[model samples]
Target: MRRTARRAGKALGAGAAAALLALATPAGTAQAADGVLSIDGTEHEDPSGCFPLGDFAPPKIANLTDGTAWIWSGPSCDGQVTQQIDPGTSAIGRGRSLYIE
Candidate 1:
């Protein structure tokens, strides 16, 4: 009985650690082909074309597509284009425009 109780306690501890890790990890918008675009903190998932981002540039963004994505500094797929971001990668200074092709 005592050994059983100890094993249960260890299992609980492991479960708690896994939960903590999941919470600490940044979550991506799963399986989005076009990825999720954040313009001035607003998230846009999937589809294409200019969506009128106004003047607010995105300070950070994430690539939630199945493949890789490119983030640009300016609108209309122009300006400082970032390197290919794999799925689920996120960071700051990703600029305003995002295109996944």
Candidate 2:
């Protein structure tokens, strides 16, 4: 009886750990609103290409200048690439680039 109880306790502990891990994992969705970006409930800004860009339901650009522009590449949380509009400068939008790099 004691051995059975010990085994049951161990199993319960393992199950609890697994549950915790599942809860800790990030969600597969992202949220964007009012020009703000978020991923798995975490606020993010100027995220790198590796970060999920979330649903591309719509494209919005912020902080535009004569030589810079931002573009949304897709309709899903794939990734975004930034391109330079000028031949030698990192600025974008001057060359009328259709998409990000």
Candidate 3:
């Protein structure tokens, strides 16, 4: 019984660590800023042209099975931006404009 309890505790700890890592890691759609734009004191790269006022960082991006990804700005923010990129594309270069709506 003691061994079983230990195993369960270890499993729970592992699961929590995995969840924390997932939250800390940025998604594929999140492009790291190249010190170009600054918004709300956070350096962000806005690929979508919608939020032109300043730089904005998306909380997370959802990967769809149809080769498209959905970028979520925030938990309460209703607006979402979708980006279409080539399958081989990985990173966005500096001075490049991302589509925003």
lDDT: the better of candidates 1 and 3: 1
Output the number of the lDDT-best candidate: 1
Clashes of 2: 1
lDDT per residue, candidate 3, 1-101, as tens digits?
99999999999999999999999987766443222232233343423332332234432222112232223333322245333433223332121123322
- Candidate 2 lDDT tens digits, 47-91: 333233344332222322222223334333223534323212232
TM-score list, all predictions: 0.43, 0.33, 0.29
Model 2, which residues run further than 4 Å from truth? 29-101
List the candidates ranked by TM-score, beginning with the highest: 1, 2, 3
- All candidates' lDDT scores? 0.64, 0.38, 0.38
After superposition, candidate 3 runs with Cα above 4 Å error: 28-101
Each prediction's Cα RMSD?
13.3, 10.7, 12.2
lDDT of 2 at 43: 39
lDDT value for model 2:
0.38
* Superior by lDDT: candidate 1 or candidate 2: 1
Candidate 3: count of backbone clashes, pairs at least 3 residues apart or interchain:
6
